[model samples]
Target: MPVRRDRLRRAGESAFGALLLTRMILMTLLALLMVTGGAWSSWDTARDALRPPQGAAGPLTLAACDRERCTGTFGPSGETVALYQRIGREPGETLEVALRPGTAEVVRTGAPGVLYACLPLAGSLLLAGIVIGGGLRMYRTAWATAGAGIALLATAFALW
Candidate 1:
């Protein structure tokens, strides 16, 4: 009976070790993917903000204005579009916005555009931090990553 109990304990330990190794590998791969994706998205967004496509540039008639989002209509064709920007504009006003490439969404140019462009990078870091802290148990690194994200967001908000 004692021999059987010892064998069971050894099996459980081996299983736990394998599980931990698999989790570490998965966490590393996920972290790498997140960093790569975040960088790509950040670059794309920033480039678009800096130099928006001329074909998509136009004036929009804003119908509603809130803190985070604005609803508006665009074109002589009256195409409905949602502008996800934190621009300081009032409803019943016409604002010039450029469509994000390949999408109906618009981002304000200049400072607002740049600020909004940073959001995806911040989000990615935040998500990666959560995963690393919870899944990989790297508490300090996770906190640092989260702190960086917060700083990035704060800077964007201040500049916006």
Candidate 2:
């Protein structure tokens, strides 16, 4: 009976070790995916920023009319230019500016591409690390470390 028990224990240890190795490999893959996604996102943002403004009929100009009122002119196309008034503008100051199309849509569209790609990768890594680390710790310490790790992984997934 003692010999049988020792053999069972060894078998269990071997199985656990295999599980741990698998988890580690999965975590490494997730990390790599996250890094690649982040790099792609950075590149997209840079490309968008460097793009020149298009379809400009002429240069836009802004002239101060008074302390509170300002007039903006859109070159030959006579396109209605949106004006944003700053509170700090002093009286008799003419701030000439060129009107460009808003890039908010572009940024908004690009953000999801980056986040969706990276978030899943990071989340998977975190989950695998938590599960393996917690499982091993729990076996050694007979504590609730595994539960804690799972909870942390769940929290990260929720936030992501």
> Best candidate per lDDT, number?
1
Give the runs in model 2 whose Cα sits over 4 Å from its true position. 1-6, 50-160
Candidate 2 has its poorest 10 consecutive residues by lDDT at 103-112
Clashes of each: 0, 0
Candidate 2 accuracy as lDDT: 0.43
Query: Where does candidate 1 stray beyond 4 Å?
Result: 1-12, 35-44, 53-83, 86-88, 91-106
lDDT of 1: 0.80
Tens digits of per-residue lDDT, candidate 2, 27-69, equal: 5565455445645655543343344246432444454344544
lDDT of 2 at 4: 52
Per-residue error for 10 in candidate 1, Å, reads: 5.0
CA RMSD of all predictions: 5.8, 12.8
lDDT of 1 by residue, 1-160 (tens): 4545678898999999999999999998897788678878988767777787867767789998888878899864377777876556688888666777667787666775676787888888888899889889999999999898888888888776
